[model samples]
Target chain A: MWKSKAKFLFLLPAVVWVLIFTIFPLIYSLRMSFYNVRIGQGDVFVGLNNFARVFTNEQARSAAFITLKIVVIAVAVELVLGLALAILFNRAMPARGLLRTILTMPLFATPIAIGYLFFTIFYEEGGLINGLIPWKVPWLSDPGLAAISISLVDIWQWTPFCFLVFLAALQGLSEELYEAARIEASSGWQVFRHITLPLIQPTIVIVLLLRLAEALKLFDIPFSLTGGGPGTATQVYSLFTYRTGLRFFDLGFASALSYIMLIVVMIIVSLFFRHLRQIYD
Target chain B: MSRKRKRTKGIIILVLAVAAALWAFMPFYWAISTSLRSPLETFTIAGLGIPFIQFRPTLANWIDQLSIGETQRALLNSTIVAVFSAVIALILGIPAAYALARFRFFAIKNKDITVWFLSQRVLPPVVTVIPFFLMMRSASLLDTRTALVLANVTFILPFVVVIMRQTFADLPVELEESALVDGATHFGILRNISLPLAAPAIAATALIILAFTWNEFLFALTLGSRQAVTIPVHMAGAVDTRGVQFWFMAVRALVAMLPPTLLALFAQRYIVRGLTLGALKG
Candidate 1:
C-alpha cells in the first residue's frame, strides 16, 4: 500500500502541472470563447456570438482554408521527396553518414531563422532564387507564389525528418524478403511495390500524421517571412488567431478561432489514429 | 547486361543524392556567407548575387549584433529560460517517468497517462496561449522571464516525460530488483542505478528540450514583450524594426542556430532515437 502511495506521489507533480497548465487553460479558453473579451474590459458572456463571428469572419474562413491547403500540399510533397532520398541513401554508398548528417541540418534549424533565410532567398531582385534564375519573379509579392514559397520553406526544413524516419524504417526491414524476391527474378519495381511499400506503410502513416499536425499549427514561417503579408496572402490559421488575440486584443474571438482550430485538428488526428488502429488490426 | 544496368542505376542514385544534399545545405551556406559579408557587400547586387567565393568577407554584422544590448539580453534570456525550463521539467518528469515505467497503478493505466501527456504536446499552442496570456497578465508575470519559463515548461515537460518513460521502460528491471534486495530504497535505486544508466538519454532529451524551448517563437512572442524576449523573438524584431538588414539577420540566425546545431553534432545518434520517441530505433 505504501509502495502504491509512493508511486502516486511520484506522479503528483506532472499531474498537477497538467491540471494547472494544460487542462485548466483548455477549459478557460473554452469558457473565454463564449465571452466578449477585450483589453481593459470585463469579459461579458455573449453565448455563441464569438463562434458565429469565427464562421462569419472572412479572414478567419480564408485562413482556415489556406492552412489546410498548405498542410496537405507540403506534407504530400515532403513524403515523396523524403522517401526518394531515403531510398537512395538506404543502400551503401561512400560518405553515406556524412551525406545524411548534412541532409538533417535543416531539421534542427530555428524555424524563424529558416523563415529569415528564405525571406532573403525569395527576395524580388536580390534574392538567391532570383539571382540563380534568369527572369525576375515576385516571390513574396504575388499571393500564389508567397504561399508556395512558405510551403517550400516548410518542405525544405521537414523533408529530412521524413527521410530519416523512412531510412530507419527501411533499414529495419528484413533481408530475407529481398533475397526471396531476387531468387524469383522479380523486377525491382515489383519487389519494392509488393514488399518495401507494405513494410514501411506504418512509418509512412506516422510521418504523415506528425507532419500534418505540426504543419496545421504553422505560424513562425509566415509570421517571420511575410508577416502574413503582401496583404493576407500567407496568413495561416495560427497567425490569424495570433493577430486576432494578441495584436487586436479580441480574446473572445481569438478563443473561438482557437477552438475551431482545435476541433479541426482533433478530428483529423482521431481519424489518423483510427486508420493506424485499422492497420495494426 | 545486369551489371551494366546496376552500375548506371547506382551512378544516377549518387547524382541525385548529391543534388539533394546541396538543396538541403545551400541556404545554410548562404546564411553563413551573408553573415560574413560587409553591409555594403550585402546591399550591393554584385556582392549579394554570387556565392561567398566572389566576395570580400567581413564580420561587421556579427560585431554590430553582438554589441547591441538587446541582442545580448535576448540571448541571455533564451539560455536562462531554456536551461531552467528543461531542468525543471526533467526534475519533475523523471520520477514520474520511472513510476509509470516500473509501477502499475490502481485506476489509471500507464498508456492512458502517456497518451494524455503526449496529447498536451499535440494541442496547438494557440489554444493555450489566450488563457495563458490572460493568466500571466492577471498574475503580473507577463513580459517576464518567469512567464516564458512557465509556458515553456508546459510544452517541454511532456516531451521529457515521454522520452524518459520510454528510456526507463527499455532498461532491464533486474538491476533495480537486485538493488531492492540489497535494501536500497526505491529513490536510492533510481538515483544510483537507473539515473546512471539513463544519463546519455537524459542528456539527449535535455538538449532536445533546450532546442525546442530556445527555438520556440509563438509562446515567447505572446507571453514576452521585452524583458523575456528570446533569440527567435529578437530575430523577428530585427526583421520588423530593421527591415531587410540581410547581413544582420543572417548573423542573428546563425547565433540562434548555434546551440541546437552543436548539440545535434554531438548527440546525433540519440537525437534520431529521441525524435521518434523510441518508436524506431536509431
Candidate 2:
C-alpha cells in the first residue's frame, strides 16, 4: 500500500505541471467564454452572449471564411508538392541521400527567417523575382497577392515535412511488390498509380490531415510577412484570434472563436483517422 | 537484345532526377548565398547572379546582429526556453512512456495513449492562446521565460511522449523484467536497465524535440516580452517596425537561424525518423 502511494506520488510532478500549465488554463478559458470579459474590466456573467456576438460580427465571420480559404489552398498545394517530392526521392537513383538532405532543409529553416527571405524575393523594387517577371506585381502591397505570397512561403517551409513522412513510408514499401508489378507488364505510371501510391496511402492521408490542422493554425509567416494586411487581406484564423484577444483585448470573443476552431479540427481528424488506420496494413 | 536500351533509359531517368532535385535545392542555396554576401553585392547583383563569387564575403551583418542588445538577449532567451522545455519534456515523458510500454494502467491501451498524445500536437495554438494568456496572467507567469517554457512543454510534451514510447517499445523488456526478479523496484529497473538500453533513441528524440522547440514561433512570439523574447519574436518586431527595410531585418533573421540550421544538418537522420513516428501506424 505504501509503495503504491509512493508510485502515485512520483506521478505528481508531471500531473501538477500539466494541470497548472495547460489543463487549468483551458478550463479558465472555458469559464471566460461565458462571461463578458475584457482586459481592464470586471467580468460579468453573460452566458452565450460572446458566442452570439461572434456569429453576428461580419468582420469576424469574414475572417473565419478567409482563413478557411487559406487552409484549403495551402494544404492542397503542399500535399501535391510533398507527395511528388516523396515519390521522386523514393526512386533508386543517384545522389538520393544528398537530395533527401536538401529536401528537408526548409523544415528546419527558421520560419521567420524564411518570411524575411520571401520578403526580399517578392519585393517590388530590386528583388530577384522582380527581375524574372516582365511586370512588377506589388506582391507585398497588393491585398490578393499578399495572401498567396504568405501561402507560398508556408509551402516552401513545410512541404518538406510532408515529404519526409511520405519518404519514410515509401522506403518501407516491399520491393517485391514492384518486381511483381513488373512481371505483370505494368507501365511505370501504372505501377506507381496502383502499387506505390496505394502502399503509402495511409502516410498520405495522415500527412494531409496533420498539414490541414497545422495550416489552419498558421500565425508566424503571415504575421511576420504582411501583419494581416495590406488591410486584413491575409488575416488567418490564428491572426484573427490574436487581433481579437491581444489587440482588442476581447478575451471572451477570442475564446469563442477558439472553441469553434477546436470543434472543426476535432471533426476533421476524427472523420479521417479511422480510414487512416485501415490503410496501415 | 534489349539490355543496352534498358540501361540507356535508366541513365536518362537518373539525369532528369538530378536536374529536378537541383531545381528544388536552388532556394536554399540562394538563402545561404544571400546571408554570406555583402550588402553592396546584394544591391549590385542582378537576378540569378551568384551572390557568393560576385562580391566580397563579410561577417559584418552576422556580427551586427550578434552585437545588438535585443538580438543577443533574444538568442539567450530562446536557448533557455528550449533547454528548459527539453528537460521538462524528458522528465515527464519518459515515465509515462515506460508505463505505457511496460504496464496496462486502468484499462488504457497502448494505442489509446499514443493517439491521445498525438492529438495535443494537432490542437491549434490559436485554440489555446486566449485561455493560455489569461492563465499566465493569473499565475503571474505572463511574458516570462517560465511561461514560454511551460507553453512549449504543452506544445511539445505529446511529441516527446510519442517518440519516447516508440523508443521504449523498441527496447527489449525482458532485461527489465529480469531486473525486477532480482528484487529491483520499478524506478531502479528503469534507471539501471531501460534508460541505458534506450539511450540512442532517447538522444535522437531529444535532439528532434529541441529542434522543434527552437523553431516554434507563435507561442514564443505571443507569450514572450522584451526580457524573454525569442529570436523569431525579435525578428518579427524588427520587421514590423514602420521604417525598417528588408536589408536590415534580413540580416537579423539570417543570423537567428544559424544554430538551428547547423543542428538540423547534423541530426538529419534522426529528424527523419522522429518526425515520421506512428506515420505508418496511421
Candidate 3:
C-alpha cells in the first residue's frame, strides 16, 4: 500500500502538468467554441454559431483545402527524397559520415533563419540559383510557385533527418541475409525487393507518419516566408488560425476553426498509428 | 584487383556524398557570407549577383545588434526563459521518468503516457494561446520571465519525460538495487546511482529543450511584448525596426543561431537516439 502511494506521488507532476497545459486547454477551447468571447467583451453563449460560420465561410473553407494540399505534397516529397538519400548513403561509401554531418547542420538552424536565408537565395536576379544558372526565377513573387518553394526549403532542412533515420534503419539490416540471397544467385533488384524492402518498411512508415504530422502543422516557414502570400495562396491551417486568433483576435471563431483542425489532425494521427501498427504486426 | 574496384566505388560514393553535402549546406554558407560582408560589399556583391564573398568583411551589424540595449535585453530574456524552463522540466520530468521506467502504478501506463506526451508536441500553439494567456493574466504573470519559463515548461515537459523515461529504462536497474541493498534511501539511490549513469542522456535532453525554448517564436511572440521578448521574437521585431539590410539581418541571425548550434555540436552523438525517442525499440 505504501509502495503504491509513493509510486502515485511520483506520477503527480506529469499528471498535474498535462491537466493544466494540455487537457485543460483542450476543454477550454471546446467551451470557447460555444461562446462569443472577444477580448474587450464579456463571454456569451452562442451554441453552434461558430461551427456554422466555419462551414459557411468561403475563406475558411479555402484555408482548410490549402492546408490539406500542402501537407499531402510536402510529406510525399520528403518521404521520396529522404528514402532515396538513405539508400544512396547506404552503399559502401567514403565521406558518408562527413556528408551526413553537413546535411544535418540545417536541421539545427531555426525556421526563421531558414525562411530569411531562403528569402535571399530565392531573390529574382541576385539569388544563388539565378547567379549560377543564369535564369531568373520569381521564387516568391508568383503565388503558385511560392508554396512549392517554401516546401522545398522544408524538404532541404528535413530530408537529411529522414536520411539519417532511414540510414540507421538500413544499417540495422543483416548483411548475412543479403549474402544468402546472393548465394542463391538472386539479382540485385530481386534481393532488394524480396529482402531489403520488407525489413525497412516499418521505418519508412514511421518516418512518413511523423513527417505527415509535421507537414500538416506547417506554420513557421510560410509565416516568415510569404506571410500567407502574394495573396492567400500559401495559407496553411495553422497560419489561418494564427491570423484569426492572434492577429485579428477572433477568439470564438478561431477556437472553432482550431477545434476542427484538432479533430482532423487526431483522425490523421490515428490512421498513421494504425498503419504503423500494421507494419509492426 | 577486386579490392581496388571496391575502393573506386567508395571514391565515387564519396564524391556524390560531397556534392549532396554542399547542396544541403549552401543556404547556411550564404547566411554566413552575407553576415560577414560589409554594407558596400553586400550591395556590390548583390549587384553583381554573387552568392560568395568577393570583398572586405565587417563587424558593424553584429556590433549594432549586440550593442543595442533592447537586443541585449531580449538575449538575456531568452537565456533566462530557456535555462529556467529546461531546468524546471528536468526537475519535474526525471523523477516521473524513473517512476514510469522502474515501477508500475495505478491507472498509469507507460506507453499511453508516452503517446499522450508526444501528442502534446503536435498541439497547435494557437490552441493553447487563448487559455494560457488568460491563465497568465489571472496570475499576473504576463510579460514576465516567469510566464515565459512556465509556458516553455508546459511544452517541454512531455518530451523530456518521454525521452528520459526511455533513457532511464535503457540503463541497467541493478546499479540502483545494489545501492538500495547497501541501505541507501530511494533519493540517495537516484542521486548516486541512476543520475551518474543517465547524465549523458539527461544532458542531451536538456540541450534539445534549450534549443526548442530558444527558437520558440509563437509563445514568446504572444506572451512577450516589450518586457520579456526572446531572441527569435527579438529577431522578428528586427524585421520592422530595421528594414532588411540582408547583410545586417544575416549577421544577427547567425548570432541567434550560435548557442543552440554549439549545443547541437556538443550533443551531436546522442542526438540521433534522443530525437527518435529510442523509437528503434526492440
Most lDDT-accurate candidate: 1
Per residue, candidate 2 scores C-alpha lDDT tens digits across A1-281 of 01233344344455566666666667887788888785676888889988888789887787787777777778888888888777777767777787677666677778777777777778787776886788888998998788888877887777878777777777788888889999999898999899988887767777777777777788878877787888888787788888888888888888888877888888777755555333221
Candidate 1 clash pair list: none
Ranking by lDDT: 1, 3, 2
Task: Please write out the lDDT profile of model 2 over residues B148-209, one tens digit for every residue.
Answer: 89899887787776766666777877787777778888888778888998887777667777
True contacts kept of each: 0.58, 0.43, 0.40
**What DockQ would you assign to candidate 3?**
0.48
Q: Which stretches of model 2 miss by more than 4 angstroms?
A: A1-12, A272-281, B1-12, B19-24, B37-41, B242-244
Could you tell me how far off, in angstroms, the CA of residue B167 lies in candidate 2 after the best superposition?
A: 1.1
Better of 2 and 3 by TM-score: 3
C-alpha positional error of residue A185 in candidate 1 after TM-score superposition, expressed in Å: 1.2
Give each model's whole-structure lDDT.
0.85, 0.74, 0.77
lDDT (Cα, tens digit) per residue for candidate 3, span A136-158 = 88888998788788878888878
TM-scores of the candidates are 0.96, 0.92, 0.93
Residue-wise lDDT of candidate 3 within B163-251, one digit each (tens)? Answer: 78777777887777787678887767667888898998899889988987888877787788889988887777877677666886787
Best prediction by TM-score: 1
Q: After superposition, how far is residue B176 of candidate 2 from its true place, in Å?
A: 1.1
